[model samples]
Target: MKIRCSTFLNCHLLLFRLYFLSLLVFTFATTPEEDPSVIVSRFQKYLQINTAQPHPNYYEAADFILSQANSLSLHSQTLEFVEGKPTLLLKWPGSNPNLPSILLNSHTDVVPSEPHKWAHPPFDAHLDPNGDIYARGSQDMKCVGMQYLEAIRRLKASGFQPIRTVYLSFVPDEEIGGHDGAEKFADSDIFNKMNVGIVVDEGLASPNENYRVFYAERCPWWLVIKATGAPGHGAKLYDNTAMENLLKSIESVRRFRAAQFDLVKAGLKAEGEVTSVNMVFLKAGTPSPTGFVMNLQPSEAEAGFDIRVPPTADQESLEKRIAEEWAPASRNMTFTFKQKVSVHDKFGKPILTAADSSNPWWTLLEGAVKKANGKLGKPEIFPASTDARYFRKRGLPAIGFSPMANTPILLHDHNEFLNQAEYLKGIDMYESIIKAYASYVEHTRDGASREEL
Candidate 1:
């Protein structure tokens, strides 16, 4: 797989661990002692740890989370399939262990940040009197990760024990995709043993007051197209040169890209409804020792794209499109994949979960939202990719929800932040969601489909 440098959700890992680890000691100074039980304080404290990837502070975060689990008397364990990349699981056992469990999942890693671009240091978790807590993961997700624990904290304090065991999973490296994190775990015996009935993972923040819940997401497809030709002097005009071939391929891809964007621009399709492609990066041409352009032409060139295809699209058709139009073999251009999401589960059925009556879990989730006195926007496929797809790949049903209302989508952007009132409100929101989903008294009927479970 090509290592593409990314911003946050879109980041390809670049800059080795040393660059990030060097910032650790400076970023790790503890936040002043505050009432750990206080929701904001806990959020701030959790945000203080620099769990930004390519080298996240997973151990420290796990230690803190395990301690919190202990305080609530919830059973907890840390699993490390790839040593150093920890998956922290906290369980509030249900009244009946025989039933399937509910999972509340959040990633512990955030994208790297350039400190100069932020009003507050990315790792500072700075909270002003205005209620905006400026930090890297504050909005992208450390907020939701801590909210899961705080919600459980309140539930425990209120003497509430859910009937179905509820688990909060703090996974690593989600920013780069959950391959080493949720992906490995979801396919493991430990995950299978849990018998996950439903899953709720991070979603986008809403600029509008109505909260958004994602039933599906546009699938991720990362591709690198390479072209080769004879090297020659820049002054020599050669037909079928490497750069020329690459530009042709890129233009074809860009034209297709423009067509998709045009659909959204014309209001004929939502951004999530069509395949979106951005030229992530390009490489070609020789570097000059001290000038702007090199005097020699390079023999090869490559271009990478971050492509997202909506769930309803045909995977085979897309592959054909790439083969025939984008990087045609006829042009001496060949493409390799970093990721191309499979369209179906092992059963060969389409990989979409209904948030409507088609799935029983939908009913339960909607009821929980209504009971919480929160308005849920119409269910839609998430425009971007997320870790939820990992669980979905295992024939599991997962919902992507962030519970961040009236907030701009600042995730992965400079000065990413969330409001204090909004943060606390999310705790309340999760408390209700957890109570409703976990406290179900009725048992799922035998042989129920993954959606029904």
Candidate 2:
């Protein structure tokens, strides 16, 4: 039956209302609910799998990470460089394609640990009385990995897709310089595809109340020096022998080391000093193979050093200094200097983040930490290093961060464990940071920058 004009207008409004209700239902059906706890629990479960270096059961971890990505309806891929080490990449679509993307990186592989030495089995995700989860990878990385996943999961669940794409990378071998992991990933075209405006990687722990944020990392330069001289009888003078030359070289290096030590001791060097030179290995003459040839001069001697230099220092300066001061002409000791081929090939250029770099991203982080009842501590660069360096080297504005507040950190050492309060606080810290950053993208980019991203 034909309706009157007044009634027709009312009917039209009813139809519109029905359509809006249907749309809401469709949206809710497609979007998952955001559960921060769910994310953390997922991470805890992930930690149960062993992912140690050399043979981290990477296949198992990769499958798990990929499965979660698939469940989230996100695109995931496993990049393989080494035979057994697999890197997993997961991407979430953004509403706007024009905005710059953000890359969240984490390494799944950890260093070998002796479970017998730990209070709990390193692989077992054992929770203590205070709710602190104890595990080998807990402090070093597994925690951070969960933070990344949880953040993205919440964003997706809330139907709050980012304006810029967010790429999650769980790579392998970062503990050992990322040979088949982050390093190779950086060189690949996959990274080039990411119009990454800002990156967030792992950071070191600060034992003191202050938080340590890393802007740059010292590049590692591993050097091996060998000396060869005359081998003679036990009663010989042994002048100009391999032992003498090696000792001289060692003394020269030690002198430089002493200066650095003094600087550190005197408070002249901050946490992230300009350089740190450590002698890791030294072997000269046969100890037992020759069976007590005390008086004879050995023909071969070797010394190895792990040298770290500030980003400002170039290869030329390092080499020149080693030649002049480390093995000077006056020493009259001929030596062979050998560096790891991989070290020289890729990391020859120091990876650095200038103090004055124009990264407004830092401001966002500062706000997040503050909101979580944490003040922005001194922005100290990392003395050691992290996967952040790889992203920084690729010219992405990367920040290495950890959110455990006012807690003792014992990463890579004996009796390492995060306090129960600190672990829970980290969840809050990550939630705040992710919300802030995600909202920032939404407001800045309005679905127009897909090509740029």
Candidate 3:
């Protein structure tokens, strides 16, 4: 009887031990740390990190990206061309490192959002029942950054080896301007050493089933025109008053702006193909305790214009018009022209990437998209500037692409969101794209074959 009781107790103890051990294993496996392996979870984690300007939390973003790089076993480095702003670079070395590398670039910084305007908190990264992930940067670009990582993760898991090196660059300050980020990095020694063949960057979402790609982008030219003339009482009408001269210039700009807009409205030109100019600011007043001294006209009036010029446009002709008509010296107006970016490469060639069969990279990209069960729209010029312009200025071929089809273009807009299904599909698309780009080897080049195992 004693032995029977002892044996029963032992059995119970053993079973309890085994059950507890199993519970422990399950708990650890299902922990939050393990959740990142799930793509949507990982994306939400990235979106939760507030990297919005002004005042981006670059350090935290860098750490998160570095953790991902470590998980993938890729070599990662954080470079700061400017203090307080970091550029994260991750390299997945190919079997044949001698071949030119492929660069995947994404900006980490996003434009600031008003939380009150969003259905969910902009930083919350909420997923509605409709499967839309709502957050700032959901469409503007953070989606592309994570898609690049998830695609690489899938490729690595499949034990795929590349014939050419692959690099991912997460840069900052693109929302304001890339001066502290991509612009500096593109001109850095590290980029020069990479021997990059082609670059892939962010593109706009399409409202249709076909994904859009950009071969070139418009250059931004910020213009400030000031008019100086005799000051007088607001009620007194005088010839060549500060406001009068400024109004003439503004009228001239309005006419030119209308002509450019008419082309788009008439379907004669796409928005990207025309020169777009809009007045961003106007200043001419005498300050008072209330708001302004409405009784008096100021001696000087100023207006700032944001202008986007296509590479195909003649820049000299535009500048000449600005001097002779828009802010002519004869009209008592002076102007300051700030070309935010150059439209030409160092060799004076237009900063453009060929989208046709003439460019093997484009062919590879097109076929890869098709293989992924995706359709690409006709290549067009990006209506605004992007970091691709920096790469293109270096005479490197760069493509602006984002695989978001059947989605509204809500970048930098209120209630920006990306559908979970669409985001997942983008990962698959990028997987095909990365695989195709990394495996391609030019037969004409010496030693272009894959390295021996």
Candidate 4:
């Protein structure tokens, strides 16, 4: 009696698969939503903690976040490079262990803000009569950090474990280019072992009622141009002097700037367009006893340009123009160029969420935003670099998103704030986004045929 054991094994496999599917469906059936007031309070608490950049109060802010994670019974860790600068990381487990992961990331450090310059003290976290929260990091990012914590807390409280693990990363130095912060963290094994599939980072406010999600950002390259020419007397007529070459370079750069400015003003490119080049710093000659000497013919002159180029712009073309047009005269003068020091030695690769990529995360995000009582506005990619660039370079689909409606942008400026209505609404908005993403992954994740795992 050679009974076929293969038949019995096949039957067992079928039962196991059916049971697993049933469990997944059951998990998806019960996902809890967060409260709006609770969300606002959490945000206020975060804003009260002063985490200013350069000398960020990491201990105070990281402690507050860790305490909330502890209340949720999440195993959170505080990672610090220097003694006072700290970063917080929280992890929530999932049902299907083999599934990919998601990361909710925000920076703790805010740029230094003057209290007198603002309507309310930058660290006061004051809620105005109209319910507007006035603070430094209020709109720039503390809102996102608070929203992430609130959503995760409510989700965990409702006994809703995700299908894919969720990791919350709170970093420092994002305002200063993230060298001691996001860039360093990205290089660590912690993120590598997590195998993140998606990342959500901070972005700008929505001038309209709907939120904006950024899929791509232009790389920022700071170039310093040094020109040296003949050191002739002030009375002598100098043709190819340092000042002459420097002025020529500035004029050439100005021409490019004017073109970009016109393109931006005409609305040729969408929001977050890469069309601006700001000359942030300039230096020339030696400082006189009273002030800068005007009549002296300085031997050497240097200037710095903050250049933001779109991914479509060819670097070689621009470099050639600068070298040829701005190059110093030979025999009498010399030219030198250098890149400004940044946290990441090299610029991150420009990323784009392919229109035909396997994951239609953007489409799903749009639907989620609409469901949250906001109309689906246009999805514009960011034109400046961000921490989102770090995750995208690692092959994770990263989106720079923020939920602040009808608000003027004051990022990196004085008097930053967020209205109470917008802040609370943001909580509702993120809830919809997270729920929609989770449900989609749970139900239709299998619909997309499994690729080479």
Q: Assess each prediction's global lDDT (C-alpha) against the native.
A: 0.84, 0.71, 0.90, 0.73
The residue pairs in collision within model 4 are none
How far is 40's C-alpha from truth in model 2 (Å)? Answer: 4.7
Best by TM-score: 3
Question: RMSD to native for every prediction?
Answer: 17.4, 5.4, 9.5, 9.0
lDDT of 2 by residue, 16-72 (tens): 999999999998767654454555567678888898766788888888888888877
| lDDT of candidate 2 at residue 152, scale 0 to 100 | 64
Clashing pairs in 3: none
Off by over 4 Å in 2: 1-40, 287-292, 329-350, 354-357, 441-453
Pairing residues by index, what is the TM-score of model 1? 0.88
Instruction: Give the range where candidate 2 is weakest over 10 consecutive residues by summed lDDT.
Output: 339-348
Between candidates 1 and 2, which one is better according to lDDT? 1
The sequence of per-residue lDDT tens digits that candidate 4 reaches over residues 141-237 is 9898888777666566566667767788999888888877787788788767876666789878877776676766666767777777767777788
Residue 307 alpha-carbon offset, candidate 2, angstroms: 1.0
What is the lDDT ranking, best to worst? 3, 1, 4, 2
- Cα error, residue 284 of model 4, in Å, equals 0.8
Indicate whether candidate 1 or candidate 2 has the larger TM-score: 1
Where does model 3 exceed 4 Å of error?
Answer: 1-37, 443-453
